[model samples]
Target: MHADPRDARSVIEQDAMTWRQMLIVLLCVLLNGLDGFDVLSISFASPGIAAEWGVDRAALGIILSIELVGMALGSIALGWAADRVGRVPIMIGSLLVMAAGMSAAALSTGVVMLACIRLVTGIGIGGMLACNNAVVAEVSSLKYRAGAVALMAAGYPFGAIVGGSIASSLLVEGTWRDIFWLGAGMTIAFLPAIILLVPESPEIILRRNSPDRALAKINRTMKRLGHAALDTVVPIARDETGDSSGLFRGAMRRITTLLVIAYFFHMLMFYFVLKWIPKIVVDLGYEPASAGSVLVWANIGGVTGSLLFSYLTTRLPLRGLLIGVFAFSFLALVWFGMNATGLGELKTAAALVGFFANAGVVGLYALVAASYPAHLRAGGTGLVIGLGRGGAAAGPAVAGFLFVGGFGLPLVALMMGVGSLVAAGAIFVLRSPPKAPVRP
Candidate 1:
């Protein structure tokens, strides 16, 4: 009996998540957490780095934004590459790049050198995010897909929380260089796990190989995932032009466009808070150590918010849920700006702001993962995220300009609040297409 090549989703949907599947998701989460540390480490160390280098706010803003520029480029370039190459190779290679860049960043003599190194590091991060999101979506059952992505997204802020705590403690005796070294060390340590435990997406194997080869790969994966072997693996019909180009053609064009716009605004607000909060805390009279701790509290809120959003995904439509999250974020940002005068109030406000803001952003990740088919998943996600990095790049730099121009905290908060409102509106207009089975 000739078995038509089956969509990978059918295999995944039929099987309950076994240990192997769970482990894959867990590893992805851990990797993403490390990414959080690497990406946000500069924020934690910015105060010390600036003071040591005598870098002004505007210059420091450039330093902060440069990595995002690289991330934007990396996401598009590497993410598109992952559709053709395998996700695992790109992910592991990205980890190595991040490790090298972070270590080199520790030795930089001037801001320019550090900025260039950070750009390289951001590329790895961008590539890793695209791969990680695609892997999690492809590997998990549909029932658990949103939750897995949310959990993976939470790893970032969790890493930020951990990194902040470490940075706070190290600031007592160590310089900012010490923090970068630590990030590098942590990134290097996670590499072996990816090699040993994480498997390539089975869907990718199907798309890239001959039918016989694809069947063998899928059966092997199925056995490992604790599922029965198929008699035949059927391939889905696809455009012959290529998987990556399919993102902009036909129905995908609108979905891709709206996702980019929503993510762009979401990232703008999210990164503004992530990159600048520590400095803002210091400006409010907190010491560097105290600022780290405050940021930790904010990330704690981020973790909680991700988990909360994960729960909500089960009950609400993705667009409606996101709209509510962005709306709540706007209110929270406004409140935090106005009411966060005392230290206690500031911490509380930071937590609330992080909760709403981070959740909104991660929800977009889940939405993108769910919206696209397997063939274009990584590239589509990467393109949206890469384009979104424009907002991420702009957010801190614009904030820096405002800071230098004598903009007050309340005004800055109002600007971010406006971004949140815009993000909400963008997602509200986004129309999701029918879910496609996992196939190239």
Candidate 2:
């Protein structure tokens, strides 16, 4: 039988996911993992950077956060662009930009140059994050959507686990620049894979092309995916180039607002642990390599938690599940602050914090992926992440300032832990979007 293009979405919903589909999801995971490593590369190298430059916590905080600022802008800009132009283009371009920025970072001579380079790298990452989530959502079967996104989100920690292990080994014999070089090499390596393996999402084509044009394009995609073709095409109500303001329209306005709030607060909790763990361990008189090892323990916990959370997503209500995860995240983080004294204690504490903190992140990504309609998916995700990254950027920087101001670890951790609790409260009020197939 000739492939029918019109029912492509229904095929994705009702049928078993094909290897091609699974490959697309896996690609998203690998891309996200690379992004994970690039973002954390700074954390792993921070000790060496500080030692070589004689930088203080206050300055380092700004350095740590500047890339996140770029990420915010990139998520907003590139995410919108992805919806307009296509996800594949934004993703491919973001990879090249990331490679360039990482390469530049390797050659940076001063704090200013490194911060600027890292910020550029972050712009690439932000675009990738927004686009990758949308791709995973559009490609997966309804039965697999939640678990797939959870697994994709898990890649961040998986990348960190792999990258941190390598960084730990490298820092012993190499300088901080080597880390950026490694990131650059890895970033370049993904460019060809993305170009060859990923096709533009069918929904995006339908949105951007006229009914006749859309049918031709979508049929091409359907053929590529080995799905049946549709006899006719129906365009969605939105314009070819979707409006960003649509995110604030009617019921969507409230959903977007709540998602942004929840994400912002949770990121505060998440990045605080991720960005500070290595430096915190180093400050405790551990070698930089040992500090990196502590962070590996954290990502190991993150991988485990993310995988476990993905499993639970199939059985539980997403909203309730996220709230529960956030609550546990708060308790775990505070525990880490109050009790992490010895090396073993620090490793254990970091692991616990990573488990719950990253689980909360995976849940949020699942919610975001399921929250908006096809036309608005990437844009909505971008706006949420773009603004929420303020908290991500602030988490470490705020902790840095607090430490510089003489606040103890326990007090600072308590303050940071509140972000997750507040996030849980926000989730309590948020209703799942009517369009989402998952249980509310």
Candidate 3:
């Protein structure tokens, strides 16, 4: 039998990245940057915020965990919702919630109030990231989608740089509230653009009860871009067929397992170092400013991984590249944690770890994304992240426990390094379906 036209067209659309695709990637990346910046800012200003509110550090840690809690909930709940309710509405709602939480943070006088507001901010961060990343992955043409996701990811680090720079300057003359105000301000600017520019994911719409409406959305997306000169159009694949229960699908189980394992190990290493390294550097006798600079180098390493791996992803198999990158990261962390004698060695190791680890994590998302056909992409995306978020949520807390228990840097590093190895093994079991085309 001839293949359905709608299915063919929809698949084609999700598979490639056009100019419009780039715009989506850019917006998602910038929004993600805003998210990343907020996460970093809290760390930078934690002491100041604690002092101003006269709260214990434990209270501040709660405030910090608030967003992560929201993200774990967001990825699972909102990802399910995105597949059901739609991508654009959830994305827009995320920004609004983020704005509310951030504004509340700027206005708070006590730790309880700050944590409450931060809970709202966490919801926004979780929802936006879970939904948008899925949307970006689902809407792109197959050839460029992986790299596009990577390119969009570049926004995250840039936002961190922006937030850090603003914090550094404001700390000299202002309070931590100024940092929240800055975040609220940045998110607000993007809010309007998202409303005007972002359309719903064609894949999600296609899976709905109304194929006619889904096709209309496709035409609208094509018309909005002024490029309707196509010989083929992707059609809606399912109303009930295939699978929507992202994690339960047979095709997804292994991919989901692999992606989550990778995300966990990567986040464990990422957060452990990010949370403690400044203090670690200080313990080694560096000045406070110099200690913070080690992270700066590490963040740069993450950026390098994001960019470089995005390139390699297009040229190489996703699983192979992730394995190699994680292996490299594992070795780098063990070396850095065990034998880094000074600032120079630490910086080198930190960057190398960041490069491989961060990219490996993103590559997992892209890989899981590809395993699902159009109908399940959003659900699959969310489930993978929900698992990752679980790991992420626990990573820092685990690190704190280890640190309080007097675990040495090498011991913690060994745990994360071994985690990476486990993740690499998990990827070996993952396989895309017989029907789905291998990513180019």
In terms of lDDT, the best-performing candidate is 2
Runs of candidate 2 with Cα error greater than 4 angstroms are 228-231, 237-246, 249-252, 369-377, 431-440
lDDT string, candidate 3, 20-106, tens digits: 657767778788888888766666566566456664433444555556767778777876777778888998888888877777888
Question: Candidate 1 has which clashing residue pairs, if any?
Answer: 4-234, 5-233, 5-234, 5-235, 6-234
RMSD per prediction, one decimal? 3.2, 2.5, 4.5
Q: Look at candidate 1 and tell me the lDDT of residue 391.
A: 91
lDDT of 3 at 101: 75
Clashes of 3: 13
Q: Could you tell me the TM-score of candidate 1?
A: 0.91
Give candidate 3 regions above 4 Å deviation. Answer: 1-21, 50-63, 110-112, 204-218, 229-235, 239-242, 249-255, 278-292, 314-317, 338-346, 429-440
> Which candidate's TM-score is highest?
2
Assess the local accuracy of residue 223 in candidate 3 as a C-alpha lDDT between 0 and 100: 48
Give the count of colliding residue pairs in each prediction.
5, 8, 13
Model 2 lDDT tens row, 276-369: 8888989988999999999999999999998988788767787888889999999998999988689999899999999999988878877876
- Give every collision pair in model 2: 3-228, 3-229, 4-228, 4-229, 4-230, 5-229, 5-230, 6-230
Estimate the TM-score of every prediction.
0.91, 0.93, 0.83
